[model samples]
Target: MSKVIVLTGAGGVLCSTLAKALAKEGHKIAVLDLRKDAADAVANDINKEGGKAIGVAANVLKKDSLEEAKNEINNTLGTVDILVNGAGGNHPLGTTSNPHFLKEDLLNKDEGFKTFFDLDSEGIEFVFNLNFIGTLLPTQVFAKDMVGKKGCSILNISSMNAFTPLTKIPAYSGAKAAVSNFTQWLAVHFSKEGIRVNALAPGFFLTDQNRTLLTNNDGKLTARGTTIINQTPMGRFGEPEDLIGTTLWLCSEGASFVTGVVVPIDGGFSAFSGV
Candidate 1:
């Protein structure tokens, strides 16, 4: 069944893959991103492949930008039946240099050391706004057209950090946690309105955003990445393609009874403890 799907951050590696997959399934895609060129490139690829798509520049942080994009999408692709909130990432300033804090490091701060105390408030706020508020504002604008509309669904892109806060990237962890919480809140709030809200808490996927952190310049796994692989009982990092099946299933009628749930696609990372 072809439906109108609006995907934020479709310019990125993961969401773009999802967008292309959805388009292959006959959904009209609205690829929204802050970068017009990036969004257009994705849309153009989809169109070239005989899919319907339009790229729109949208700043999810601002309501006016989202409203404008909404109007354009409504005019072009029809009312959005599926909204995928994928416009979120962590900022370097919000990260700590070490995964854990050492007592001596507090007294003898290295030049490159970014301890939790060194975390910038502006960076924290930016991360929170990008991940949490970013999702909220888009839903505010697009979900309006979905009201009382059958088969309408929303999928938020959360992270495994949302379940258990990872080290160093505190801002991202906290913001994603809020996203998971809000997914449940919105699901219940819109239960009577026929809008289903759910979230996907992805495990470690090697996207450009975290590629540097996860791998060295020589392309070997970094210590943190090794730890992640070891923790994941499946002994592998997830590919963007790994998420497509789950994504399509969640958007399909098969998940009609499912809402307010954050599904983990982390290759058993969420299940196994170090033991």
Candidate 2:
């Protein structure tokens, strides 16, 4: 069945891939992102493929912006049946150089290394809002029309960090944990309305935002990236296409019975124990 889908962060790597895939499946898609150019480009690609897509630029952090985007989507392609909350990422300022810090480092006046003690409150708040509230705001705006609608679903983009807090990114990990919690809460809250809420916890996909952090100029995996691969049971990084199968299944009739679950497309990283 053809459905109207709203995809947040549609300009990003994984979400853009999903938007195209959904469009190819004949869904009317609204590609929303903070960057209008990137969103337009993805929508344009979908149009070139003879698919239906509209691009809308909006900030997920702002409630009004999300409502405006929802209005645009409604005006262009009916009420949204599927919502993918994909607007989230880590900020360098919110990350620490190491997972733990020594007392001396905390007392040091130097600004060379940013330890947990040095992580700024503003940075932490920025990440928390971007990932957690970002998901909530969009859901509040779009789900109003989805209540009691069959085949309505909301998919949140969580991370492996949510299950177990990743090193160097305390804020991101905590925020994603909240997202996972909210997914369960919303799922149960909207169960009677026939709106299911679920989440996808992606492991380490080398997207454009993390490419430099994970790989060197020579295109080889960095030491940290290599460590992630070693810990993963599959011993490899994930590609954007790796998520398409799971995404489609969730959005299709096959996954109608599934809800309030966090599906890990993590190459078994979430299951591995570093012995």
Candidate 1 per-residue lDDT, tens place, 1-275, comes to 88999999999999999999999999999999999999999999999999999999999999999999999999998998999999999998899988888887788656767888889999999999999999999999999999878999999999899999999999999999999999999999999988899999999999999999889999899999999999999998999999999899889889999999999999999999887
Please list the C-alpha lDDT of all candidates, in the order they appear: 0.95, 0.92
- Model 1 accuracy (lDDT, Cα): 0.95
Q: What is the C-alpha RMSD of each candidate to the true structure, in Å?
A: 0.9, 1.2
Using TM-score, give the best candidate's number.
1
TM-score of each: 0.98, 0.97
Q: Runs in model 2 with CA error above 4 Å?
A: 107-112
